[model samples]
Target: MAIDVKPALSPHLVVDDAAAAIDFYVKAFGGVEIGRVPRPDGKLIHAAVEINGAIVMLNDDFPEMTDGKSTTPPALGGTPVTIHLTVTDVDDKFQQAVDAGATVVMPLDDQFWGDRYGMVRDPFGHQWSLGQPVREVSYEEIQQAMSQA
Candidate 1:
């Protein structure tokens, strides 16, 4: 009956330490904590956050449900997917994440796609790609660059 959340495709993450992860997101990515629901056991059942105008839901892993398949990225031998963030200043954003305990997966570099980009592995084993648009490229230029790469 309630329709407060409007994002149709928000990502829901399961973190081993939801509280810490929430704090990290707030500090490193400028996320706003909008709502949180906690369980009787003092674990978070659900937490809603807004990151750069996009909703990203998260919660602590519940081993009781789904037969313990709610494992973290490290437990599953690393995640195949990476979260990408587009910020105004790639350098500043990248450094903030690093200072907040993210390890560099790929150093910052300007790419053929006309963006300053870099990758990082968060403390909780999540990979994040930081990017900032530096220039606009035509479709033909992108095709040519793709062919060369």
Candidate 2:
């Protein structure tokens, strides 16, 4: 089924190759490609994928389309923004992403905030953080943990 909920905020990515990025997202995060609109030159002008109930929009790097303002992460050295995904199985999902050609940026570890979390960078230069809550963590406890850390 297609994404039913319309999120107030959704990430829109400018990638070097929108089609390849969509394929990678599907393999790595079990994303569903909802739609794709291509330019006359055959490059994707707009594409939407749904992952974990959220829509992630993407398009090929068309500098002319944005008055040369928008660029891909590689062109900017690296991305400062990281998409975060909350999953039921962080380890499994993390491994799946890795198996699908994502490079590990951080090893999966249990954090003081009660989550098993890690990060990966996809081949298209997008970074993603995968997290799973392993236990209930109170604000006070988190504060204490932060203080200790």
Candidate 3:
């Protein structure tokens, strides 16, 4: 019998400083610390945080995992993935993130697709797209809307 399976893969971000990253995540996105593991040397080996309902895993740079040195993708220039989140109030959440030190990448605005969407870069250097569904559009309506655009 073929079994169907779906595993939720939480994006893992390797930061040069996991402690600061955790604090930044909490402030910038209202993330809550779920757990953390520290090395005997006092370095954070791993940590998990909950943003809304999803879990995000983070850790201090472990060169062994990469090539001998690891750092934020931004420090290396660009990132490979962007984390997106759904919220009830995109505007207020976006502002709260900004007040907590996130850099606004896109101002919150209602889009043609019917979501109040915006983007921000957390102090930890991760990009996040915050969105709130404004209206539910049928597939046919969306197609028509896109065609008109």
Each model's TM-score, in the order given? 0.90, 0.91, 0.85
Clashing residue pairs, candidate 1?
none
What ranking emerges by TM-score with the best candidate at the front? 2, 1, 3
Per-residue error (Å), model 1, residue 41: 1.7
* Higher-scoring candidate on TM-score, 1 or 2: 2
For model 2 the local lDDT of residue 78 reads 94
Best by lDDT: 2
Segments of candidate 2 deviating more than 4 angstroms: 1-7
RMSD for each model, in Å, please? 1.8, 3.2, 3.8
Write the residue-wise lDDT of candidate 1 on 1-149 in tens digits: 98696537887888888888889999888889988899888789899889888888989888778586867787788999898999999999999999988899999999888999999998888899999999998889999999988
Instruction: Name the lDDT value of residue 131 in candidate 3.
Output: 96
User: Which candidate wins on TM-score?
Assistant: 2
The local distance difference test score of model 1 is: 0.89
Stretches of candidate 3 exceeding 4 Å from the true structure: 1-7
| Model 2, global lDDT | 0.94
Query: Better model by lDDT, 2 or 3?
Result: 2
